[model samples]
Target: MTRRLLLSYLGLALLVLAGLEIPLGWIYARGETARFSQSVERDASMLAEVTEENIEEGKTAELPAVIGEYAAESGGRVIVVDRKGIVLADSGAGSAAGPATRPGTDLSREPDIAAALRNQTTVTTRTCTEGGEVLSATLPGSSGTTVRGALRLTYPMTTVTDRVHRVWLALALAGACVLAAVALVAFTLARWITRPLRTLERATTQLAAGHLANPPDATTGPPELRSLATSFTRTATRLQHLLKAQHAFAAEASHQLKTPLTALRLRLENFEPYLDPRAHASLDETIEEVERLGRMVQGLLALARLENTATTPEPVDLDAVVAERVAMWEPLAAEQYVALAVTGVPAGQVWAIPGALEQIIDNLLANALRVSPPGSTLTLARAPGTELHVIDQGPGMSPADRERAFDRFWRASDSHHDGTGLGLPIVRHLTHASGGEITLHAAPGGGLTARVRLRPAGPPPRRLARRPHTAAPSHGSTSATVPGERAGG
Candidate 1:
């Protein structure tokens, strides 16, 4: 923008200079030529009067000495023609002349000389071998309207042309100076206009990174940019406050809800011993429901925390995480008569929010394990790129259910399990925060395949060593995932 502004200023200045300088130069050149011609005419008129007096006094042969002094002083050639159209004298008379026509030469046929004999005074320029470019002024040598002879004077055009050249050179130098001044002023103006915008740009990048570290100054730049900076600062401040409030609510609400649900479960368990045999089942069911509600509350808070925080992605080894998770869930799968297996080529490092990959894998594995039938295979697979696939030999969701699965608390209509339906949404939030996406496709066999796409973390970091690592939602499940794929606040 600054460059463009400078160019525009230079372009306008050039146009102005061309408009003024071109005409001024041309007029100056023409005026110089006219002035030179007039000066030549004045000199020629005085000499013509002298020629008339000499011819009347029969002293024509002495014309050379009389005109020689004037010709030497003025740096020009002179010619005196008789009434019969013959040359009486030439300026180059008795010396080694430089290409000038000598004495007794006929200059009567020359255009200016012929016009002079016709009693006319005239000035014209012509090119000639002897004089290069010639400016000639001629007038009649007349006494009482009877022409005695004619006098013609010629000067080289370089005398006037050199002055015109100097004037054009001066104009060129002046124009250059003006353009330089415009460039300096334009540069200053452009920088002034764009300084605030650059500051605003940096401020916006900081805001996107979860907080605005340094706000832009609204006191500089144009009024429009200043107003924009002020508005952006205000908006970023409000958003920060809103995020802080949300985190506070998530923490407070999780604590507030967990205590009462635990007390209620204890009260229901107490009632179990006093109640009859038939009431035992009812008390147990009530206790289980209360526990499920508690898990739902936890899932909700986890999601709230995920939404409220800004997490930058870091490199995590996908293969290592998958192997570890499968090992941890293997015992659980075995007890349920299902096989927990890891397959597919090793995907190297991938970028994910620090704790997010572990949480996502936990939720998906927990969900897949719950839905897998007895003796079915549950696979934690890593594709060649930055994808993790959890294939479960469970009842897969329909197309419509899959599309809406990521919605908060959205369970399939035919879902019979006790899930609160927050698992998939949480997984999606974690994936997006890590700069990736999640999609559900039908499993290759007769199950569901949850395909988790992630950003490649490039090469693994040089400083880290292999590290060992480490929860979930509803159905009273200790882990984050529940049977009905439920989640909470």
Candidate 2:
């Protein structure tokens, strides 16, 4: 933008200079030529009068010496021609003694001399055969009304041309100086105009990255730019306030409901022993419903806290996190007659919020266990680029279902599982907040693979000898200790 603006300014300067300098230069050249011609003609006329007097007094031989002297002083060539169109004397032949005729040097054939022979004074300019320009002036010599001869004066046109060239050179220099000044002014103005916009751009980027503590200043630049900055700052402030209110309401509501829900669950458990067999089954369902509601409230509160809190990243043990989560789910895997295994690097560190890795693994494992059939395998692996993958041999979702899988309260219709549907959405929000990514893809054979990429913080702590290892569920009917697994199971 600055370059374009400066170019436009220079273009206008060039246009204006061309408009003014061209005609003015031509006028100066014409005026100088006319003035020089007029002066030469006057000198020629005076010499003609002197020559006429000399002829009448019978001293025509002395005419050559006088004309030669005048020609030498004026830096010109002078020729004396009789009325018969023949050269009487030539100053350029050095002696100016007598009728000196050079081949092809007939004075009568020259335009200016021809005009003078007709009793008219003439001044003209022409290019010589030698490729230089000359100005010639001719005056008729009259002896008491009878034409005696013609006195012609010739001078090189370089004198007038050089003068005109010098004038144009000076104009060119002045125009260059003006253009330089204009370029400097234009550059300064462009900088002044864009500086504020650059500042605002940086501020806007920070805001989008969740850094809203400092807003752009509105007091710089022109009035329109200032107004734009002011509006942006106001909008950011309002958005910040509205988000704060929303988080506060979510946290407060979730925290307040926990006490009542816990008390109700305790009362229900105490009354369970007196309930009939049929009523017991209904009470168990009620208890499960209450637990599901409690988990939903807790999930909402967790999401709100994640939004409200700014968690600084730190190095977490990826291998350790996956191993621990799989261990906790091993009992449930055995009870379902499913195999749980882990592979890849056993000691890798990734940058993530504290406890976030554990929650992600817990939720993914829960979802896999609920859908995975007996004899199927659940594989947890750590790949390069700080990536983790959980592959389950279960019925996976279609492309369209996967696209909407991250939306809260969305579930597959063909699934036989009961879930609140907030698991994947919460995982997505948490992963994004920690500057990571999560994606779902079809497994190699059949089923789904959850791929997660987290930022690397640093190298893992050195441990003992390393070796490839895997964990599979033991043969038994059992249950596993689940962490944050209520929503998906």
Candidate 3:
């Protein structure tokens, strides 16, 4: 983290240095050059006027001395060029004697000379190999109608370039100093920004781990971070309240179920004397009812625990779980002469709470078998995505019965076997908790099919995409193979 922060600081510093220094250096260099060129142009124009005046007065002998003195003081070269481009006088080197080397050359071809001949002063700085190292400008003057000439002046640019370079160096150093200062400030501020965030992370982890003894300190960092700490404190307070309530409920529920179960067990012991068939049937009925009540109480306690416990999810194998449950219940189905059939039990996994998938299948099959007639088949099939269907050819319910099947303690008819009516309710709750669903549908062959869709524990098998189906016979139907196909009562 520190390395990243330092790198970020250096990046910002370089950007600031470039932004402040590069353009400033370029402008300084251009301005200094422009000023030096303009100065040379002004001096050249003044010299042109002085030369024309001296020549017209026929004081040509004084011209060279005057021009030379001006040129020396100005630190530049001055030359008078005649109409034919002949160097008539050289201020820095005295008069040009005999035929000048550039005699009879066309002055019109030169940009400054062309402008001067048009009676306008032209100022420009140019590099020339022959004219020595100088910045030069030109202006035209006329001593008479026959003597038109140009006054050209040149000043060396080395001094100006040196000053510009010095200014550039100063700017770059100042920019570097400023960048260093900015980087220090930014580093300190970034640390301040992330410090509160780190504290908040630790606090949140503690909260998730059930550390409820002390709340996070509210007085830390900026206003936003302090506000976040306050929110965590409030949320922790609420969780503590909820947990207390859940504990109380579990304790109370456990105590309440104990009395009924003890009384029922004692009552059963008193009914052992009857050896007649009627007395045996009565004992069986009472025992079944008591057992159903016990199961209901157990389910209620389990559901309460499931509600209160913090459920950390893990992968579960739906198909294997379903098959295991079916194998366990196979003996019961066989004793009743009811055919138990299972299909599409793939060797795959799903994501659910452990034991939830088994419980769901058990409830579904139990309900189907209770209503089914003897010799009928109980079918179970698993589809893609951890989908399980327990279809039974039992006495199917109307639409109203289907809707209220999951309601707690609901019963469609009491003429059938005694049940706690909590089976479907528990099934629904467990399914929801496991992030799955349960739906009741009419089977294709006219029985009830309980479809259980669970979250896949692993990726689906990459094979044939055929849809799986399982069919079973109806319970209490006319074509029953078993003799005692009595409706469960």
Q: Which candidate is the best by lDDT?
A: 1
- From the highest lDDT down, the ranking of the candidates is 1, 2, 3
Q: What is the C-alpha RMSD of each candidate to the true structure, in Å?
A: 5.7, 7.4, 10.2
The worst-scoring run of ten residues by lDDT in candidate 3 lies at 477-486
- Give lDDT for model 1: 0.78
Q: In terms of lDDT, which candidate is stronger, 2 or 3?
A: 2
Number of the top candidate by TM-score? 1
After superposition, the stretches of candidate 3 with alpha carbons farther than 4 Å from their true spots are 1-30, 39-80, 84-103, 109-111, 114-120, 124-136, 141-148, 151-219, 264-293, 307-320, 335-337, 349-354, 373-375, 394-442, 446-489
List per-prediction Cα lDDT, in the order shown: 0.78, 0.74, 0.66
TM-score leaderboard ranking: 1, 2, 3
lDDT of 2 by residue, 83-178 (tens): 755676667732222234552357788677787788888777776555677887888998555888888777788878899999999999999999
Model 3 lDDT per residue over 298-317, tens place: 55565555555544335776
Pick out the ten consecutive residues of candidate 1 with the lowest summed lDDT.
461-470
Residue 246, model 2: lDDT of 82
Error of 3 at 211 (Å): 8.0
Candidates 1 and 2 compared by TM-score, better number: 1
State TM-scores per candidate. 0.75, 0.74, 0.59
